[model samples]
Target: MSEGDRDHSTGSGRLVTGAAWAALLLGLWLWGTEVTDVRHGLSVPATGDMAAVGRPAAAELPPAAAPLKDARPRRIDIPSLRVQAPVMPRGLDDRGGIDPPPYARSGVVGWYAAGARPGAAGAALFVGHVDTEDRPAVFHGLGAMRTGETVRVFRDDGTVAEFTVDDVQVVGRDRFDARQAYGVRQSGRAELRLITCGGTFDRASGTYTANVIVSAYLTGTGP
Candidate 1:
């Protein structure tokens, strides 16, 4: 689909995009398992051996309600492809920010705050649909992204976190894995996962059968 002809039905109403189904599966897999020894290259600190490095003791807390103090994201820009969209925080009660109404003709990117923050200790997620029933969706070109591309996320604090594309994969709707897409950790550096609809459109299901996931990692911190 062309950029302007993109679809946005996935995030609205009863529409369930392939990405959403993957997220649900990931959650179900994490219900009774404990993640251990997450590591990246040399840059990320080792959380499993905090005491070996002489760090003070830290208390454990419930995973679902873990507290975070990073700055909220305010804007998202992809310069190489000329994409600029205002960022909206999204969470329970729509606490983050209201995304543009589905099928909106304007250029507005949406954030999924129910996920994690980029460069933080969790999986940061941003999602947009591939198309609307009548027009092009905001993330139509997401599948064309290549490795080594940069995606800059501007935050409310005036700092921008830059991430380098590491990998991109397409998952079947019924088999998408959320933990691999949203919960994996590489050191302590912030990670990002961008999602959009792909694969053949099923008119009967009213959604696509697969999701395209673009994974990246923080490369630098700057203004």
Candidate 2:
């Protein structure tokens, strides 16, 4: 579970920044579709040189549900991974990159407050630490998710926005393209992105070699 925590310390800034976060933030701002085919294979892990987990050809996903009204996310539940955690709103840092949840709060997920809310019609971005100095964090199992799985977002509007996992990618730092990673896959649909440090922990660069991006879209709503 702590595969990427070796030699890392709290407040080290190596894990988050090392995952090529600056490039990710840069890509987030540009929102173009210069490239989209970033998937590598079905259920591929974000370890070693592998980049993303492609959806299976035979997977029968549900139709997209109409987007809900804007609401602040209160919590997120990923039953397949047995992860349930609070959602915190985060803003950009002075350097224009996301200010992710601090290491001390690695168990929670950080949402880009300035962007679309989880159940709204744009890609709502959430980021978390893969591992801390001693244990795996909230998104540690994110890369293992497969298509058709459910990602439920509890909102302040008293509704549960259920999303279906569609795509998973492990975007490498050198080839990091914002359009490919953060760009909307389907227009007018409510999408969710869960990102975390992935790939191997590079001792030389003091950061992870890549990032894991999980894409899901709203499929249903519940009370």
Candidate 3:
């Protein structure tokens, strides 16, 4: 080949290689930035739908030998997870939908009143923010929970309901399946669904791409 043609070919190869390296570097930077944002809880979604296994049928719980309305959850404790917080009656806000509070100091442990009660026949729904304004909040360490861990719910009626973790899974926020998270259920047993934000974060939108849900079932109860 002529000297001029050889020189041109070599220059083009270098240009292509440099462009490829630049693209790779850009992708790594974006990925790292996303991870940082998620760790800080800056871009995670503020709300998510609970997924369940099956739809619960409408049936009255067996009459307690004693009335136990006073036994509703008042505080939640997970010793292995180092979580201890008072339960609040977190119902629908003015928007008429279930959403976790934006602030950590809200001190609200939300409950899906539309779902079943603890120790009832259906899955009881609970949602909380992992963090807010970069401050750790309730359920912050929820992602670290493993199967067999115990979650204690202290009912107002002085009864403590204990639940054993069954599984934890992460699903995309846009693909969150509420029925699979909060509706499906088995017979004669109460279930629990806990949700928080996780997965990749998007700095442009300031939210995570997915949510982490932890499922559990009633193991027993005590005073």
All candidates' TM-scores?
A: 0.67, 0.84, 0.64
Task: Assess candidate 3 and give its lDDT.
Answer: 0.52
- Quality of model 2 by C-alpha lDDT: 0.76
| Model 2 stretches with alpha carbons more than 4 Å out | 1-15, 18-20, 30-58
What TM-score does structure 1 among the candidates reach?
0.67
Give Cα-based local distance difference scores for all models: 0.55, 0.76, 0.52
Model 1 bad stretches (over 4 Å):
1-69, 92-101
Each candidate's clash count: 17, 2, 14
Off by over 4 Å in 3: 1-70, 94-96, 102-107
Best by lDDT: 2
Q: 1-223, model 3: which lDDT tens digit per residue? A: 2344335545221111111111111111221111211121111222222322232322322222211232366778888667887765555444344545435343456665545566555566676666554455677677666567788888766788778776566666555544444443444456677766666544444455666767777877788
Q: Which pairs clash in the backbone of model 2?
A: 27-178, 51-170
How should the candidates be ordered by lDDT, best one leading? Answer: 2, 1, 3
Candidate 1 per-residue lDDT over residues 93-172, each given as its tens digit: 23222232244443456566655665555567776666665555666667666556788888877788877766656666
